[model samples]
Each structure stands twice: as structure tokens, then as C-alpha cells.
Target: MATIHKLIALALAFTALVVVVSPATYKEGDPIEHKSLTLGEVLDGDRMAHSLYDIKFRTDVPSKKVLCNVKYTEKMLDVLRSAIEDLYYFEFVLDDIPIRGFIGHLEEGGFLPHNHKIYLWAHLHFNIEYNKDHIIYANVTTKDQLPISLDGATTPMELVFTYSVKWMNTDLSYEDRGTRLRDNSFFPKNLEIHWLSIINSLVLVFLLIGFVVIIMTRVLKSDFARYNIEDEEEADDLDSDDNGWKIIRTDVFRFPPNKNLFCAILGVGSQFLALATGILLMAMAGMFNVHRHGAINAAAVVLYAFTSSKLG
Candidate 1:
């Protein structure tokens, strides 16, 4: 009985150690308290009117959406009515830190039509940095619209915002300074490909290559062996109306019409294949900056154009 009790204690200790070593999975914690957000006073700077778009946390009982509540002054409404461009600035407090952002025109168009509800979409960009289960800070800016009619009547408009958050572990033992978010950049700049994804892709490529190799080596070799044997055995029987691929041997080697066009197409295809392989190799080597999508696209276009000479 004493031995059994000792075994149970050891098992419990081992289980606890396993749990401690495992990575943690996070889910959205309780709707972050709305009381944590405080709206500041609105001010007009150089005829540019600014106001807070009070953010509210609605319970799941009704629906899951962040509601914005803002009061507009008559002068502000008048300015929005005639103004060609305007931006509303505001800030909110979170965890005793102030997060600043702005809302303004998202596009040249003043309104967006959706399901009979004329809406204006807002571009909400958050400048935030995160440390795993530790420190999270964010600043937000929006390109949202306030609907106003030519008649000067205030129209009810909905502000739609989309955002994403990236977290990092800042514990000194595992700190990655490159992954740290910058204040000037709204999006995380670190580009990392998970080892699992890379391994899966490599496995798929190897499987496909192996399949092709087997088909070419084993299957084709067997077919060629059988065909050659038939040719030898039926050398004299060939003219006796036996139909096989040997009958079209002459036609199989016949050149296609418009040989120049065909050769050009083959050359272009080979060039493209080489270009694709080089691009893939470069990507694997992390030679290109993945954070700058525009730069990558421009580089691809330039490379393709430069390699076009091989198409000849």
C-alpha cells in the first residue's frame, strides 16, 4: 500500500511537469472592459474639427459588434457638409496608456452602397506591439466616413473597422528583437515561415517528384520492354494487318506546321520554368523582403522582363 501511494505521487508530479512544458493556447479573454477606454475632449485645430468616436462593448445577448457613439456639433456637421476633406482625431486609454488614432476619408467616394444602407467604410490601422502574455500596446488611426447629404440633413452612417494583432514572447531567455513592432509601422514586419508548413511543403514536393520518377523509370521501362519484344516477334507479321504504335512511327516523328512559332513557344516556356525555379530558390534563401509586398511585386516584374530575352 505504501508503494502504491508513492507511485501515485510520482505519476501526478510527472503529469504536472508535462503540462508546464507544453505551449499555451490563448482565446479572447472576456470582452475587454469598456470602462478602460476613456474619450477625450474634442478640439478644432486650424479649422479641422476633431471629435471622439466613443467605442462601446456590446454583450453577446444582443450581437457581437463594436459600436461607435459620437455627438456632432452643428458647426462640425456644417463643416463636414461642405468640406472636401476632413479628419477626426481621438484617443482612448488602455491599461493606463493612451492610444491615439484618427478617422477620416477612406476613399475618394463619400459613400458606399450596401443592402439599401448607404454606408461609409473606415480604415482602422492600429500601431501596436505585443509581448507574449505580458505587455500589449496599441495606437489606432481610421479612414472612416460620416454621411452627409447635399441638403445638409444628418444621415445615420455606420463605421466599419478591421484590425489584426500579432504577439511575441519578450522573456529574455527567448527575446527576438527583430520581431519587436515599430512605432512608425502599423503592421508587424517580421516574416517567419512555420517549420511545420515548410516541412509539409517539402514532403509534398518530394512525393510528387518520386511519383514522376517511378512512372518514368519503372512503368515506362516495362512498357518499352514489352513493345520491343513485340517488334522482334512480329517483324514478319507486321504487314498482316496487326495494328499497334509501330504503324504510326513515321507520323510520330513528323514535324509540326509553323515550326518557328512552336520553337518560340518552347523557348518561352523553358525560360519561364527557369525563372520560376530561381524565384523559388531566392524565396527559400530569404533573399527578398517579404514585408514589402510592393517591392517583391516590382522585383518579380523586372526580373521577368529582363529574362524575356531567353524567350527567343
Candidate 2:
């Protein structure tokens, strides 16, 4: 009975610690206003000329009211009309932090032309951070979508915007902040990966290397064994005329015209190869700092310059 009471007390204490460490609390904001939606000026160019539908949706809830907007261009509209897929951009503000993201369909594949009026819904996702004193930092997350066309409709197309907010009890890191800002400004939703094509190329390369290695090994072994045979008959029959490589054996091992230059070039090439391999391995191991692209690029340039100094 004493042990059981102690176990119950321990469990309650652990639960209290967890609640104090990370508490989950959230407040849903009001629905975004429609009048905030505005249109930007349209420019004319071959493919560059375009106009955008600026969606300025605002929400008044939580501690303060925040506004988010996205731009949908004519090119995007045309793509939807042509049954092609695309993602549209939108920017919004939460706690004075500008979050940018895309507005896309939940389903995969391109949108088809519809004879009747269709309703396009906008889904919004907010990534929120919960810190001390119930402070919350929120931002939008977006995904890619295909272009949508609603032509030849009896009535105007209706765009209904829906939103969901997710919260976690953790302080935002520098990387998280940088990523949110960068993604809102210049990032797109879709990342194309051609893994199949890459795999096929790698397979071809390995096959070619294996073939060369096998052929070279067999030829070298045969030539050395034939030339160095203990049997006098076999050695005599394998003459210089029969083995053309044996005739130029001395030249093959001879030094190049500029020995110093050759050595310097070889050393430089070796250093570069080593550096490249080291960097690749480190990247694969996730050793580099994320969101420090400028630092990484500067370090690479300095290292390359230091290594190239060996050429002098």
C-alpha cells in the first residue's frame, strides 16, 4: 500500500513537470475579410507580362490582428485554363512577422476544365510557437498546386478560404525564423527531384568503370605472366612483335617533358579531389550548419584559394 501510494505520487509529479515545461494553448482568430483582396497592376510581355490577384486576408484574434495576402497572376489563371498545374503565392503577417506561402489544391494532378461553375477553396495552415507567458508566434505553410480554370460557367466562381492553426510549446530558433522569412519571399512550394534519371546515370557509370577495370586487369596479368614465364619455349614464342606493349615499356615508365610542372598539376588535382570528397562526406553526415549558406560559400572560396597557392 505504501509502494502503490509512492508510485501514484511520482506519476503526478512527472505530469506536473511536463505541464510546466511545455503548455499547449491557442486562440483562433476571426475569419479573414474579403474586401482586403486587391488586384495588382498587369504588365504586358511575351511570358513576363502578367497581373496578379492580391489576396489581403486579415484575421483579428489571439493577442493581435494579423493580415496575410497572396498574389495570383494571369499566367497562373491561363495555366489552370490549359489543364496545367501551378502554385500561387500569398504573404501574411503574424506578430509583425511576414510569412509567405502558396495556395494550392489538396488533391494531386492538374485541374480539368469545368462546364459548370465550380467552387475553389483556399486552405491555410499556420505554424505557431508557444513560449513563456503563453506567447505565440504564428506563420503560414503552403503546398504546390496545379493551375485551376473555371471557364464557360453559368455563375461566378466562388473562392472559400479555410484555415487551420497548429501550435507547439517551444521557442523558435534562428534557423526557423530565417526559413520562414526566406520561404515567404523567394521560395516556391514544389521541389522537383529527378531521382530515377540520376539513378540510371549512376548505374551506367558504374557498369562502364567495372568493364574497364576487368579488361585492364586481365590484359595486364596476361602480359606479365606471358613475358615472365619460366618455360623457355613459351617465353621465346611471346616475342616483342607479339606483345607491342613490351616494346614501349621503357617509354611508358619514362618521366614527362616537364617533371616539376607535372608533379605540381597532379598535386593540385589531388588536393581538389580530396577537398571535394571531404565536403561531400561532411554534407552527407549533416555536419554543416544549416541556413549559413553565405558562410559556407565563403569558406569554400577561401579553402580553394589556399589550395591553389600550391601551383606557384
Model 1 — TM-score against the truth?
0.37
lDDT of 2 by residue, 209-276 (tens): 99999999898888888877998877777754566358788999999899998998888887788667
Give lDDT per model, in order: 0.39, 0.43
Displacement of residue 50 (Cα, Å) in model 2 is 34
Q: TM-score of each candidate? A: 0.37, 0.40
Worst 10 residues of 1 by lDDT: 1-10
Q: Residue 294 deviation, candidate 2, in Å?
A: 2.0
Per TM-score, the best of the predicted structures is: 2
lDDT of each residue in 1-312, candidate 1, tens digit only: 011000000011122221211101101231211121111111111111111222222101122233233334455444433332333333333332344443223234334552222222233443334354323444554433343222433544322333322233334321332233233443355875699998999999999999999877875564455566656556554444445555678998999899889999998888788778777887777665422323444555656777887663
Q: What global local distance difference test value does model 2 have?
A: 0.43
Worst 10 residues of 2 by lDDT: 1-10
